[model samples]
Target: MSQAPAVLRGQVVDAETHQPIPNAQVGVADNRLGTSTNDDGRFVLAIPPAYQQARLEVALLGYRKHSQALPPLPGPELRIELRISPAALGEVQVTASVVGIVREAVARIPRNYPVRPTQLTGFYRESDNEPDGRPRYLVEGLLTVFKPGYQQRGDDGEIRIQQSRKVDLRPAGQLVRIDWAGGPFITQYGDFVHRRAQFIDLKHLRDYDYRLAPGSSYAGRPVFVVVFGPRAGNRRADFAGQMYIDQDTYAFLGAEWHYTAAGLGRSPNRADSRSLRVAYQPYAGRWHLKTVWWQTRARLPIGPPLNYFGEFLTTAIDTAQAARPDYVERAQYHDVFLRNAVAYDSAFWQGTTTLLPPESLRKALLDQQRQQRADSLFRPTTPSAAAGTAPGPAEPTQQPDNPLGRFFSRFRYGASVGAWPLAVARAELAVAYAPAGYRFGAQTTALITDQALTGWSRVEYQYELTRELTVTLATQYVFRQFSGRGWAAGLSYQHNLRPRHRPLYGRVGLAYTCQTVGRQLGTFTNPDDGLRVAGTNLGADRLSLRLQTQADALQPTLGLGLELSHKFELVADASYLLPLRTRTQLEIAEESGFFLTRSSATVDLPAADVSLRVNGQPGSTLPWRQQHWLLSVGLLYRLR
Candidate 1:
């Protein structure tokens, strides 16, 4: 016999106080029939005679909920009670019965396959209390979604996601975001899996032991309750909250997660401490997530004071349906908030990307792993004995002897001057004596010749020479007038970690300069000479030794960057007045860009000590004059 039609009526009441609860939700499991409890906590439900025997769910904000099978009846007026309780996260259960099903399902998924969730939009409703205790309102919403190339933390995208104080929200229209990264919007693809980068691990569902509990209802409809647990070995994946799954399918019916503190290797790091709920339904052979509710509860001074709550929902339907797949909204709602004795309701679709989690800040991980092979490992792997050519078995471990001895092997150098410490300027020359054993790189430098502040710089290029170190021999020419030609050169044993700039380094060198009395000032040459000049033109000749220090991003691949350098130059040069003494210059003549693009700003600091000797007189002219200070700014720009 067919069951009779029945109208089940009820009043929604807070289970604890038995007080009427307004705007509470009552619905059938996975079905579209649902209603919000009015101000009176009263609701009227019409049950079709054919649709009897379904599950009913009663939900309200800040409350414990209830789910039960429905019975046919216009029966007694029923009363649904919702109890308020602190949210207790459920534990995960992994056993023998359900692991296989999830494993099989996972194996069936293609790598990098964009799930349908990638295509759907998410919308939410929220209400918040204003700082002044005024009621706030946000209602009905829509969201549009898309796949975005995740980059750093900045929010520049098609659309963003949001949630409000209300207890529920679903997918609406226009904008949506999905990020697999630890931050908001789980949009990252599967390639991010296994990388020791961000902490969110969306790829380990099967490995994490996701499944329904043993006592769940398992009829042909196969209703079951499942929980999700984290995998060992890895520490955190946003510590996402627990999830409730449909026993019959791995589809998530509900989920609760809170973000944690900053991940390891992160700057100004922080974790997510907010709670969230996600719900899904099966449609057309695919699972469509329907709603998501997130409640923000962060710890003091650091966290947001007001507990934030937001809901999101979505729906897909036939062209002729009121909620058309494109035209009609299958979901509509508003943000709910009641605080400081006031309540506000407004639309949640208008969310700002301000608080959203950072997107793909790990470009380095996606970059193909490139480990430089040791010379031995690589060269040895190449057939050391080619057919017809016995390459002596290739002894890659040995360095070709520099037979040149100490004069060459014992000498190393480098020089630089930049914008910190003093706008007054700087310059340096580093020198190192290798076979000589002692490791200090001596320096001689100068800065601000235009301002009358003479200087000298020196340094030793030898520091920590190891298996992984590269050295550079740098030569710089400061102010050089045939009347006073002064040039400097440095030999530095630089260790290059990056093909570009080195953050940490050392230098040393023996430098010499001689300024003559050719009568006229000469070309100032490149950057190093424009500010400070150190030649033996001063009343006294000098020999100096010094050091270096720095920090910056190094792109060993791109082979490009700017370095901030500081140098102590120890001057070493007695003026060379010999006729064979040479002074030359590389001139652009007119087109300066011939050597540098518009993006580069290279300033050559002019420097030279004037010890005049009017034909052997002790005036400021002949002996090499070494500048005590020099500030030269080197700017480089790359069009590519």
Candidate 2:
């Protein structure tokens, strides 16, 4: 087998200002093998043995192209600087109408761009953050894309994910979730030349006014810079920016534009602002899309503004080897790329030739991964030695020395307000502790309402299936002023939906609950005598009664959480209980002037028809064994 290619690392900067030049084209001269500098003007390229003697070229629009012989294998990092081209400084004058120049460039697209299919292998990255600069979601991947030539307008192209990793930082419990659905495919849609953006569309050319800006140089060729914007009173115009067109061939080199204020106002995505950049490189005598960068801020009605950034760089391109991706491998237009992320592969990232992410982003990604590992309930444990052999030294436990300190470190505290129908409202306090893959918790709740005094207490256990999912089992005891005492048991599944807002998370849960309603005894008035009475007696001056019930139900829950600080989160949840089975009983304790009747028979009743008598008169039906809804809002505090 042949040896692996030698790696080349370098940075490019302006020759005069010494400032780094981002997105500069860097590659082997005349070869399709190339890559672009990242935002920091840094790059990593692999040079095969065959290209050891070949020259490397670095070019950027407005900058004179730089070329030099390849450095020796395992050489020091290369630092190259490019000077501004004289032609770009307006040393050469242009006398043509800028509109005609732009028009000609648009007309030359069929000849300037490829007419046959091509394949691209590249790196893609997309990230979004909250208004305060907190990271929300990030996904980066290596991709294989199949592109139908510019002549074909209907084919949007296809992309296949090769390797990917994602980080989701949205905490659980959020009311609003934002998702950027298209992922890297957004780059394809941003290809204004092939997609015929309104500004470049031949039929819509008359709606815009174009003016010649300063001249420029791209890929060593002098180019004309034409700036265009909506004409006065043109309500349909949406974009304003500048385009680079080759002065000699009229081939469009690149363009940078942003949505106008009016366009932003009418945006369906509620965009606060949006901008895009698209560039092309001449390959084998035809121009091919080289890079796409897009950024946008969305002003949602709820929560802070969300910012998004997407970048696509063409690392290598192939026409001869181009082929369509398999149907199953193709990414759907509406697919959420995060759902397709695979396990993080350190090896692939280490060896791949891709654009380097910004230092801050890299640090954030690492910190997020570290935090996840720290918060994970399950951790790898050392295996025991074989049966016949003595055990090796026990692996050191990475924990605090004090047992009590370690024990208390696992606890979390929270408080919430809960509500149900029938004027019942409650305040709940809870505590939880997780020492391993499972958690144990308890809650105490006190109800305050006009009709009754009540309290509930519950103990629960939760087993984590993953970072974002859990299985829960709980049991509770309920006590009411007039309704007596009861107990319930339930099992549930909960999932966290990671939203784009860093401080918020949305949760969904389903549970099955089994409960028993104990005896409920209270005094009531006899309608005929105007005297206090209880228990099914309509004529007695005073009477007493008892009620009992049992029920099984399916409960569906939706919850939202908002982060208040590092140690606290505000959470709210709503749930509806649908009954599956119910059994009820009503017993008259005193009736017809009889008191403390020891031989009285209990009366069985249909749960739907049983109504409790209150204040010596008929009242609303008993809540036992009936469909109902629960709502709760609270704040959770982390103990450690």
Candidate 3:
């Protein structure tokens, strides 16, 4: 049996002014356990006994990260203070020496980054600005990124769409076309840490010449500024830019880069260029991408000049809980297409605050609604009519679908509402309405939240008994692409428990569930379009359970569950929230379960198969087992 874990408590503060730093990251260097400081810069982390000898790390943006061996035993009240980093890199601002510093920083990536899955919830915005600085098209979105351990690479990190909004204000009769692919994902693709290594990797360093210069201070920290570009004799289309690394941890802090005309895919004769700026901040002992700004311009031979500018800002980071490896099935971000996903009403917007003001957001949405309405009303019914009438605003030409288009289009919708989550490979829809605190709706289980729709068709009903209590019943049909499709139903009663502190609350509930698993559970390479299939889990299931929890915005939630069965399961999860500002709160949660008796099986995905090793033996099968184990970090937002 595993020994109980030890608890470490402390407060992270600024050294000079001695103020608490809210949302500062605190963790043990070698374990999956970690947590962030609350508003008071205080934190409590459950450290596994295995990492008793490891160091504890504390970090916040603009400040030097702090690390020290854990106390021999949980000690007295601890206060970890971080100094504001000096904004200079000593006298080593020389060229040859600067390259060495860059090399060292790159080498330290593995040691400084999180080895476990980490989730970050941030705000992202993209805009097309007119020459006068007015935004022609604006989009804002909340992002939940499941960062793979530092050992991963590329867009390997899973990105989930939380909530988003967009507004297009092109002149009624004119259209401004800018590629969405390059709008924001450029930042993801341009990740200086895990990817975009060509800028710093030793193997790729030969392509560019390096220079060193003094850089301005960032978040009050001094940095070593290094500039590099394609060698004079080597004129390949490439990026030329300056990069800054914190002098202390050797972490990449910020960069100013420009794409050459050739790099923009324009001919030498065409005047084209794009300037981009990217910045990072130290969070919880790791550097995170914080902001990206860029502007692109071109002189097209056939049409009016093209100009576009965009910016992406990250608002929060939740390091307390890591996200499930499959937090979001990556393909869904593409399959359903963000543009055609979900739509929310003004209530949603009113309930959430973003980097932009509520009034500004309202105007943007209103303008888009008006423009869409006008286009629909003015659109000619026939091609002949379109030609006969004076030309209306030039319709946006349909371009070949590209990954970038789908990514940006995602900013237009809300999280999926119906059939998208379950079927894992099929499209689904849902319809519902509620009146007087009661609701009736039909939705597919397959496509509910972030995963593929479960294809479990269901009709649901809910009745509010009071402000804090409600009762719900749902009957669902499970349809598998292969077999094992059946029916299941559940009824649950829950009561919300509130503490005097407004931001804190909890829930208690009771539920009964019944399910039937067909004899042949089919597995397909691609549920939507796979040609191969196999049978798997087979059984009938029933359960009765009771649950209780108490939590609030600023405190970690504590929950307990009891399953009423011969062999039952026990589950527990905890979370804490940190308010970054007026309407934004970052939440992180983790869950683990213990089952006296559980089902086990091995499933294969010919299309998405993964290899594994068991007890030091290489294995080709993924054993599906139920017992007690740690869950990935979950990030949630309380934005109003």
Root-mean-square deviation of every model: 27.3, 21.9, 25.7
Q: What TM-score would each prediction reach against the true structure?
A: 0.30, 0.44, 0.40
Minimal lDDT window, size 10, model 2:
429-438
lDDT of 3 at 11: 86
Q: Report the alpha-carbon TM-score of model 3 versus the true structure.
A: 0.40
- For model 3, give the 10-residue run with minimal summed lDDT: 582-591
Arrange candidates, best lDDT first: 2, 3, 1
So what's the TM-score on candidate 1? 0.30
Query: How do the residues 1-640 of candidate 1 rate in per-residue lDDT, one tens digit apiece?
Result: 3455578888888767888987555776433366556768898878876656788777543455567788547578787777664642332232332343333223323322223224445443433323342212223233443322222213222223323222112123213211111222322211221121132233544335444433333223333344445455544443433444333343434445544342222323222345555555555554444555555432334212333334544533221212212211111111112111122222221233212232321121111121122222323544545555655433223222334422232332444332111122122121221112222112222221222332323222332233223242322332222112234332223333343322332223233323221222222223221212221111112212111111111111112123232122222222212132332211112123333421211111111211222233433222223322233332221110
lDDT of 2 at 472: 56
Tens digit of per-residue lDDT, candidate 2, span 1-640? 2567888999999999999887666767443357667767898988888888898887654667688999887688899998987766442222124555666677788899888998877777777888876667767778788889888877878888887766566754443456677777965788888888888887777788876566567668777677888989996888999888886667888899999988888876668899998888889989988888888998777778889988787777888747787555677655667556355554565466434454533442335664354223122233554455554433321322444533443444555545432233232211111112212111222222344433444444444445456565656445554343333333333343433333566767787877555443444443443221224223454445555555677878888877664346677878787878866556444355655542232445533334334333443334333337767677765443
The runs of at least 3 residues in candidate 1 whose Cα sits more than 4 Å from the true structure, single-residue gaps closed, are 1-94, 108-122, 126-141, 147-221, 230-250, 259-272, 299-304, 315-640
Query: Candidate 3 at residue 33, lDDT?
Result: 47
Q: In model 1, which range of ten residues has the least summed lDDT?
A: 549-558
The alpha-carbon deviation from the true structure for residue 397 of candidate 2, after best TM-score superposition, in angstroms, is 22
Task: Name model 2 segments beyond 4 Å from true.
Answer: 1-96, 172-176, 354-640
lDDT of residue 104 for candidate 1: 28
Give one clash count per candidate, in the order shown: 148, 13, 31
Alpha carbon deviation, residue 466, candidate 3 (Å) = 42
lDDT of 3: 0.47
Model 2 — TM-score against the truth?
A: 0.44
